[model samples]
Target: MSASRRTEARLLSHDEQQLVRTTHHPAIYEHGLDALHELRRRLRALRDRERTLLHHKMREIRGKAEPRGGSFPGLADHPGRRRQLFAQALKRVNAEASRLARMTARAVIGDGARRALALRKTGEQWLRPAPSPSPAPAPDPRPRPNRRGKSHIPGRQVGSVSQANRRAQAARDARPAPPA
Candidate 1:
């Protein structure tokens, strides 16, 4: 079988796949049936939401457009104008909804492509061995004492200031005096 053909291909819910078969116009072509199904689901949900909102708006406009119980001749024509305006507004709403669907489809397709590219990059980076860091400069070899005298005698306490001073004075005394 060709690499593109899937022997074990599964349909997205047997009934829903047919409903979602159509590709979105002006959207990047999706390769997987699952992706197409998902896009269709999203578009349907968006359309449903828009429809609900538009229905509410139409109801509100209708409420505002009803003629009162007055017998005025001029008032009779007002409802007709209102109906015409409502129809125009409904058309606008539908146009906006279609635009939103197109934009959503485009965004979804783009994001999927970007994610795939990032995943490929990550896989490539992971496959390559990381460069070895340069060896750090060797640390100083001098011995360091912890708050004690330089002598390595165990258990010796050498933190006293007076004792250090006395040791220094005796060392100075033992040295021959500088020639006059």
Candidate 2:
């Protein structure tokens, strides 16, 4: 009888090794599956919530279209009142839709965050550390002066206020008095 020898296969790189391990390791695979499952759950819940919100919105719109009271003798006959009610109802529905859109967007963003966290915990090193705060900006070297230029007003000599006051009085006297 002849004995046969078996050879082991070698992985080309660290990434290949990690990939092989992830596929073969039961614990790692379970964690990864769990993360995926959680993501699906979150997506399903978001969908269900959106559907429920849409249904409620439709019900509200329908309720608004229906008159509250029995056919009135005079008030129901007014065309303006009906138009106003319709306008108000449309506004309310638009507002509700806008609110629901914002909520849906937030849910999607939250799911993305969760997925990012999962990816990070799973040994994915794509995320880099935040850069250290730029070294406190070097202190500016230029020296600041304590005070600005001369305090005296430009183009006027010192003690010129008296001359300005006398000129103002002469101009006032030159103007004719208003009719009595």
Candidate 3:
């Protein structure tokens, strides 16, 4: 790929970055992450295409490299040259992928920082102790009007294990004895 196209594929346009920062956008979207995804998609296609070309076009490329009737040409299928070429391509792909990862990480950190700042600002409001009108009043000695009922027990708690055991024992006592 050309230098310009390579850069474009790996990074968002300047205008995109500006829009992201300036607009009231949803939290889920990010230009850098989108770029990274696109880059990966394009890279996958590129690797597949390049692999196909390497298999199909090697002979054609080697033929073009053949020495004509006049001038001398280097080895048409030099093992060293072929290895170096592919190594260089692999290095470039690795570098590009690494660059995209770093950029995405930076974008994520920045987004997290912005969110934390917003949370801090909002938290500050809630953090300030709410102003109570006065000291908390003492409790009344009398029970509340609604506290009485046939369903309510004074001290023993409902749903206790002991309550269950007592009920089971009472039920056994009430049942008639089994025939001898």
Model 2 pairs in collision: none
Cα TM-score per model: 0.28, 0.28, 0.30
Worst 10 residues of 2 by lDDT: 2-11
lDDT of 2 at 41: 51
What lDDT does the true structure give each of the candidates?
0.48, 0.48, 0.50
Better of 2 and 3 by TM-score: 3
Instruction: Give the local distance difference test score of model 3.
Output: 0.50
RMSD of every prediction: 21.7, 25.4, 15.8
Residue runs of model 1 more than 4 Å from their true location after superposition = 1-68, 73-75, 124-180
Error of 3 at 104 (Å): 0.2
- Candidate 3, residue 61: CA error in Å? 24
Q: What's the residue-level lDDT of 68 in candidate 2?
A: 36
